[model samples]
Target: MPRFAANLSMLYNEHDFLDRFAAAARDGFKAVEYLFPYAWGAADIARRLADHGLQQVLFNAPPGNWDAGERGIACLPGREAEFRAGFSQALEYAQALGCPRIHVMAGLAPAGADRAMLQKTYESNLAWAADLAAKSGRDVLIEPINTRDIPGFFLNRQDDAHGVITRVGSTNLKVQMDLYHCQIVEGDVAMKIRKWLPTGQVGHIQIAGVPMRHEPDLGELNYAYLFDVIDEVSTQSGWTGWIGCEYRPSRAAQPGATSSGLGWLAQRLQ
Candidate 1:
């Protein structure tokens, strides 16, 4: 069976961020992930996790100046210092929270900049991150976000992510495969899953409705079939990782909308 982790950053918007842990637990989630945990104290979040019996599965390293639209700094030429500091802070939180994975976002590609330079910086940063994370027995993830959702996102294809991981040459480095982005950037998600899952380079997976970024059940892709595919491939490859529910609730205006939209999850578990 595929383990599903509620993406607290996107789901359970009705409740405060800290309270989302309880909401997800009440909805039967055993694990959870989110974009970033910098806003709250790690101890506070840890307390919430303990109270709710939920495990923190994933979260992103700080993206530079989010208010100014800097998605990430890992690929930028002059931001290596900032990136390392941010990642160190993220590691501290991960230790405090007992999370196993941390995602490092590749910043948007600056127009008129050398792509090779950006790739070098990104690989270097990832290499350092992976080395540090390996010492702590944790993994560092790089995701291929779609251009539609995040235009100019340096990493946008599975091949590119895997290629970078190969060059980085660290066992602690892996790809965070978001099926929603995969479907948009490259079709044939099931085939992609089958091809990559067995490689053991895929560290985590995420899902959402294509085109609308809503619940997985309301999308062009049939999640039921995909889940079965995942189950089959996982059984064969022994890939035991959490599938993150990273999508917006269709009924966000209503109370308990996130929980209400989880019928697909219940049906799958049944």
Candidate 2:
């Protein structure tokens, strides 16, 4: 069975960021992931993970100036310094938290920007990240987020992710396959997983209901069937990676509710 991790950034919104660790453990999650952990000290985050006995499955490298609408800096021109610095900080957190993987987001391309140049910059940055992460025995992941959710985002397709991985040519570099983004950008997700998962390229997988980004049980995607497929892929490929539950709870709108929304995960484990 694939180990499932709660995406604390989206789930367990009823508690403070630091407190979400205990919430996830209380709800029976052995692993947890989040978007960014830069705000809190690494030592504090590490202590929480150790206390809760939760493995840090994944997290994103800092996206530059997120409040100002900058999604990431890896693909942007003239932001190499910012990208490297952000990655250094992320590496520190990953090391402190004992995280094995980090997702490097490709920032949005400028309007009418040179596509080839963007690809080049993206590949170069990924290579750099992969090299640095390899030194610490950690993997670097690149996710192909759909443009619908993140308009103008440079990396927006599986093929694009494949190209970047191929161009970078690093064993430490792998794909972060988020089913929500994949279903929105390119449907036929089961086929995509079967095709991609066995290649030893996928380092991690994330899931949320399509169209709403809610609990997987409410999605158009047949997650139960998809989980079976994931199992088969794991059996065949000997994959031991985590499947991150990166979804918003249906009760997110209802604050202070004592619900976990883990019905899908519970059924799967059964």
**Best-performing candidate as measured by TM-score:** 1
Over the stretch 129-222, how does candidate 1's per-residue lDDT look in tens digits?
9999998999999999998888889999999999999999999899999999999999999999999999999999999998899999997999
Candidate 1 versus truth, CA RMSD in Å, comes to: 0.6
lDDT of 1 at 168: 91
lDDT of each: 0.96, 0.90
How accurate locally is residue 4 in candidate 2, as Cα lDDT from 0 to 100?
88
TM-score for candidate 2, residues paired by index: 0.97
TM-scores, each model vs. reference: 0.99, 0.97
Worst 10 residues of 1 by lDDT: 145-154
Candidate 1 residue 111 C-alpha distance from true site, Å:
0.8
RMSD of each: 0.6, 1.1
For residues 110-197, write the lDDT of model 2, one tens digit per residue: 9999989988888888898999999999999999999888999998889879877887899989999999999999999999999999
